[model samples]
Target: MDVEKLTKALQWRGFTVERFATAAEAADWMDQAIDGVSVGFGGCLTAEQMGLYPRLSAHNRCFWHWQGDSRDDASRSDVYITSVNALAETGELINIDGTGNRVGATLWGPKEVYFVVGRNKVAPDFDAALWRARNVAAPKNAQRLKRKTPCAVRGDRCYDCKSPERICRGLVVLWEKPTAFEKMTVVLIDEDLGL
Candidate 1:
């Protein structure tokens, strides 16, 4: 996957684009940006994979808990950085959230928003991206959350049933350009992050 192309696409959609070759570069950039910035983190596997939790904590800045966890603080954090399960080449982001905290924050919360994504996160197009979200990200997340959805128990693709435990209801696709805040950056990496 040519991550550079995807990064460009994201930029074309009005997102500040930053490309990093290694995890150190990405974390370093984030560390500098965190100065005087209240930071919010989503329950993203990529953030964990990049060791962002300890990095942020070591910096002594406030952290917000998205899942009512011990570390979340909704009132603070100047910015929020999270990982999406998949993004489309057309510049749409897809993520499945259990408690809607991640999506809610993404919609409107932090002054600035950042999406850290890998090359594998890009789909062929918008339709493919949504399809990947259902068949790939949603089912996997359902299983992880131990939801009672059909796909969760089957341990496979989504059945798209009317199950009350459906975790795919709050699907959001950002097709338009994002408004610029202090900074809305998208960090594109070659390594896979989440899902």
Candidate 2:
């Protein structure tokens, strides 16, 4: 992907884009940038892969559902951290969520939202990004969660199944930064991370 083009596109959409050579560099920078605050975490494999929970929790009052923290409490923190299912190089952010907890917080919750994205999550264009989110990311996540959906079972395209365990029930696309939010930063890591 063209990092320069992607950065310009995202910037035009009012997002702060920060590129990193590695996840470790980004994680260390974030740990130093954020401190002594209430930090919330969405259901993000990228953050988990970065070991953000343990690292940030040491200095910040952090909450994550993965660690038995209440979702409601985590959603109301001073800062929110999550990852998108697929990010368009043209500037669109796509996320397919089941319970809406992850996408919901991005829309309306914390004043500052951080999207920790890896190089693998970037797509060439908006349509490609949406397709990646639906087919690749969703199916992989479903398979990981052991959901009984066709996509998960076959490990292929989305069946758009009506299965009760369907995880791609809701979709969120951020074309630009919402006016209500104070800040939104996209941390682009060169390494592959998450599903």
Candidate 3:
């Protein structure tokens, strides 16, 4: 996708955008981005796999995760920082997670949210973002976690099913930039970061 177009569209949708040259720079900013944040992480291999989490972890307290391995404490900290998978050009965030930790935290518990997205996660519109979440994001995650979801078996797209193990159950879209905190920054990197 065209990064400039995507960035412009996101900006119009109400997020403050910062362009980074590389994933390293993105990770660096995330580390120094804030303080005392109750960070919540979605199942983003890009952030975790790229080694961004450790650096961000060093800065402040991570929120208590309702799912995934409980690595950080959630009660003491008031501020929150985290990343999600999908973002539309119109400035809406779309996320699909199995255990609900990713979407759950963003919905109600965070003081602020920071989404670190690479060029790959940008879609033309909200519907396109949803398509990417199901077809591109979900199945790849299923394969990574070794789940038996239909998309995992088909390796094509999401059916939006009633399966108990369906990862796409809780989808949250932030159409307006959140004003709950001092800042809600969406750092846009030119590189490919998440699925």
Candidate 4:
């Protein structure tokens, strides 16, 4: 991946970009940077890989629906952290959410929003990013959740099925940093951390 180009593009779109050599370094930085605050997390496999919840929870009040916490509880947090399904090297972030709580939190409510993206999540352009989000990330996530969707059963790509268990109900594309958010940071990791 052209890290320099991606970083420039993201910065041009008004996002602060931080590049890391490894997920461990990124996680360590996150742990120290977000100290003494209320941090909320969206359902992110990348964060889990980095062990962010336990690390961040050491110094911050951390909440996540994955831990049986309510989305409403997380919404009131001081900072929100999550990972996107796909990131366009041309400066776009794509995510598919079942409930919209994750996307909604990224858009508003939190004082700061941090996206912890892995190299595998980066695509060449917006279209490719969207495709990755649907075909790559969504299917894997569906399979992981044991959803009855065609994508999960097939264990291949997205069929855009209308199953009630479908998790890809909402699509969000962030082409630029949200003005309403007090701060937005994108941490680019070299390792392939998640789906």
Highest TM-score against the true fold, candidate: 2
Itemize residue pairs with steric clashes in candidate 4: none
Writing each residue's lDDT as its tens digit, candidate 1 over 1-195 gives 556677678778777888888766898887777766567788777777787767776764556464344334642367787888778877778876667778777767678887888777789888888888889888887887798989998977889879898887777677644553555678888776678
Prediction 2 TM-score vs. true: 0.99
Give the alpha carbon lDDT tens digit for every residue of 66-165 in model 2.
9999999888999999999999999999999999888999999898999999999999999999999999999999999999999999998999999999
Worst 10 residues of 1 by lDDT: 67-76
TM-score of each: 0.87, 0.99, 0.83, 0.98
Q: Which regions of candidate 3 fall more than 4 Å away from where they truly are?
A: 36-38, 63-79
Every candidate's lDDT = 0.75, 0.94, 0.69, 0.92
Q: For residues 19-63, write the lDDT of model 3, one tens digit per residue.
A: 898888887776776665556665566666557556656776554
**Which residue pairs in candidate 3 collide?**
38-79, 64-74
* Runs of candidate 1 exceeding 4 Å displacement: 64-72
Per-residue error at 102 for model 2, in Å?
0.5
Scored by Cα lDDT, where does model 2 land?
A: 0.94
lDDT of 2 at 117: 98
Better of 1 and 4 by lDDT: 4
TM-score leaderboard ranking: 2, 4, 1, 3
| Better by lDDT, candidate 2 or 1 | 2
